[model samples]
Target chain A: MAAHNTVATSNARKQVAAGGWLWGAVRRNGAGYLFLAPWLIGFFCLTLGPALVSLYLSFTNYDLLTTPEFVGMQNYVRMATADPKFIASIRVTLLYVALSVPLKLAFALAVAMVLNRGMRGLPFYRAIFYLPSLLGTSVAIAVLWRQLFAADGMVNSLLAQFGVEGPSWISNPNYSLYTLVVLSVWQFGSPMIIFLAGLRQIPVDMYEAASLDGASPARQFFRITLPLLSPVIFFNVVIQTIEAFKAFTPAFIISGGSGGPINSTLFYTLYLYQEAFSYFRMGYASALAWVLVVLIAVFTAFSFLTTKYWVHYDD
Target chain B: MTDAVHEVPGRASTHPRLTGTVRHVLLIAISFVMIYPILWMLSGSLRPADELFGGDAGLMPSQVTLQAYSDGWFGLQVTFGRFFANSLIIAVLATVGNVLAASLVAFAFARLKFSGQKFWFALMLGTLMLPYHVTLIPQYVMFRSLGWVNTWWPLILPKYFAVDAFFIFLMVQFFRGIPRELDDAARMDGCSPWRIYRKIILPLSMPVLATAAIFSFIWTWEDFFGPLIYISEMSQYTVQLGLRSFIDSSGTSSWNELFAMSLLSLVPIFLIFLFFQRLLIEGIATTGMKR
Candidate 1:
């Protein structure tokens, strides 16, 4: 764009640089693509190529020990009709995502609102709250989560002080998914920080005007804060939803990689891993992967579709 | 509780000071819940076996000792020293690879006019949402076929090709914020596009590059699944896999030792976060999504 004022069109100039032919056009962006070569190689060989291969693999019966044998949709059909574990993993993942995202976002926004009140030691509190999200997904943290949710672990010990007995959180099927949800909500720092940034962007005068009009704090939140903060909320929802869908390590580590307690903690990625590697069901895993992609695509489509009804951007 | 105190009959108050006090107290309590587990680990790592499972969930150990630290460091066959070097090597290389490749590609995306720009950008972003498991087996097979399994190559190479689209996207957002006037000025002085990028754009981007570097190092250091699937040799394990091995070998008896090593594993990332906190937080905050 440096030469933009001198030339009417940079594209025409770029075309002319390599002698004005289709080959010239191809050669023109060579430097740009050269800068992009690593990503381009990765995009093809790593992402899109394997993505297509996985799609093909989904339709075949391939164990790592043998060359893929064409199966023609049997994997998907089995997943839909016969594979109980696959169905269980999907149910677990949906429940986890549905429960975790809203809870995390709500906790995040509430704390963000509190931190936005100009308290002392703002950075200190923000950092402390954010510390969990930083380390939450680590194998160590997941292992600690296992211990914390054990029958005689700290969670139950604390519950005992209140004169109440607690169930074994991780080993109990009815309670296992909820423990993961609590873990998800515990790492509310990323969205909380983002919400803090958004909260700061909202003009002080908007609140002042509402206050002058005699709006209660709750009223002002609905009238002014919700509308202004909707875009940030939307971003957090989409990202966290995708993240919750992809959660693996906690369930893997907590369940000791068997997705047990009767498959209570069988997250989708964990199940896919078990299929591909543990059971050597590579074909089945690939099909499960594609099904997940479609599920996420539907959710993402819903997010975008619902935006017009609620999300408002002044720009 | 403080709200009731604010309703005193005689004194007229206007600062909203009472609510602020209540807010601070509530925030402090919540922050305790957020931070207590980490502190518990720190304390539990120091305590003897008898005190660890006791009903008291205090952040202070009854008997403070560095015995667990020494035991954990030397407990594994390969030693924590080996794990440390392996983690540092992988993290440093991956950081270098990601910063170089992401910056170059980000420059092209942000500054240069290219064909199919929209499609390529979308493709890169689309990769961000792509479940890594979709590409997991094929990549494993590809790397295994190349004889790179059980080594660092599979873990570190894709990073060189900007496989982590998040870093490139972050850098692109940073590069976009640089004024085009700077590029124009550099060009007027007979600079080529590469020279302009090197002289002007690169100088203005240290914060973002640092942000990317810190994130890369932490993530690579913390990565478990990549090494779990690829690196199987005992001597080649990173710190994360080493910690997992600790648990696998002695499930319940080595709680104090596991806690000690886990805390030690977190130190590198914690220190990096401590030093570069502002850049990383502001990077994510200002990196197009929030703004």
Candidate 2:
């Protein structure tokens, strides 16, 4: 690894040295860095550098006002053993991701298929559906979600029409998280749009051939559509899984930032926020952030590893 | 000077009319499902709080009034106007910065060849996977140390620096997609590289620029986390942060007023989207599936 790193570094250096008149060319390419400079500066100052700093901070005890004191692996150890909320948060997050991802993808695929059928005013339908996904995870919609799921809100009144009294979805612990799941599923537009595009990319001739083969609609979908769409499905899965794990706004708005009604809706990021800002447990939150990174990386790696068997990239 | 066009289809139609009718019906049904929530939200906003949840039968408002709108605009904590202004300023600034900065970087990435070009590009791509949460606390701490909190600096400054690699990457792809022949032709006509970019490339990239502008505007306007962490001063709050504060405060929420405000929040986004919905959808859908 060291030898490879050195070789790559030396090769880079030699290229730099050999390019004497290439300075003009280098400056042009360097201008790209200039365009990218602000982002690079931000990455170092705001994101990347901070990420490394946070990892270090996780091994220390630090609040905003005071200097950080090195505490070794105590934060991690304590979180693993003593933190009940930590454990509960993990369960809640996994459940949220697991429920939200498949439902969102399925809904998106179904809707995309519906829209793919040579619909009139296709743009209008696409905009309307995609609007929610664009605005869905926002604090405004989360606020709207709270009102829509309140005890005497629109949902309960609709339920009353069926003579099935509905619980206050956001306020009630039993149903609060379910409202969030519904919220996630509602924003299925982004993936739906992608699926629609992917569907369009699939040759119409193939479907025509399937029909000629006397294949039923269901049979054609199962054999042809499913196999071809596997890559898109896998892409949506990875992206949605990452997104769901980071979901914070809804739980915050619905539970009033307490992660309340017995911590049923305490998502991992919310818990992390509570630790960092609310409880002043910056070290713990830092540790939690790192853990989330690991979790996401591991899952992402696992998906990539398994993609050879499942994901059908045409190329 | 009149030209007449005529179509002659002489029994060449093969697809069934029943299939077309069935497809239309399915489409209408699908559209209804998509539109219902937004329609519900809109209708609900026009009613009084009590009437909003009155029943399924009264889904439409009985006395559609501007009371909620006025109350939303003036009476409440996040009195719509200030938040709107804040959101507008942030969004416009972010859009301007992204367009100017991302375009320059994208030009470099697409057109320029230099040492470590591939490595730098890969680095940018690699950084895309680093979730914002990992950097949230430390950024807060860093900003706090610099006393940049309770201000828009944390939100706005980072954006100017091209912190959003997504936009950079998006613009890069767009820039790459443009024909290189235009640059060569411009150069042959004695244009500088900068002149080539400004005169030729930029003019042709209007659609992509518009796409980027719309996205940056919406994303910045809707952003919650950055503002939430950085801005503690109620007066300094962006629209999203202000809206959140409304939910955070107890006993202050008039459901009708909140819904009305929510609707108001969506107006600019809605209008922008309506005007460019086709382009936005196509742009997002195509770019998304590419990866």
Top lDDT prediction, candidate number: 1
lDDT of 1: 0.86
**Model 2 C-alpha lDDT per residue in residues B157-264, reported as the tens digit of each score:** 777777777877888888888888888887788887678778887898898888888888888887777787778877787777767666555343476777777778
lDDT of 1 by residue, B1-291 (tens): 877665542222444577678888998999888888778888888988666474656677878998889989998899988999999999999999999989988998998877988889998988888878888888887888898989999889899999999999999988998999998888789887788778899989998899889888888988888998888888999998998888888786878888889899999878977998887678667752321
Query: Tens digits of per-residue lDDT for model 2 on A1-315?
Result: 999999999998889877854776665566556555666676678777899999999998888778888999999999899999999899889999999899989988987886785667777677777888777666778877777787877678878988988887777778888889998988888898889988887898898788766688899889889889998888889888888888888898888888878899999999999899888888878999999999999999999999999788887
Best by TM-score: 1
Q: Native contacts retained by model 2, as a fraction?
A: 0.56
Give the TM-score of each candidate. 0.93, 0.90
User: Candidate 2 DockQ score?
Assistant: 0.41
Question: Model 1 chain B: which ten-residue window has the lowest total lDDT?
Answer: B6-15
What lDDT would each prediction earn against the true structure? 0.86, 0.79
Error of 2 at B115 (Å): 0.7
How much is the lDDT of residue B290 in candidate 2? Answer: 19
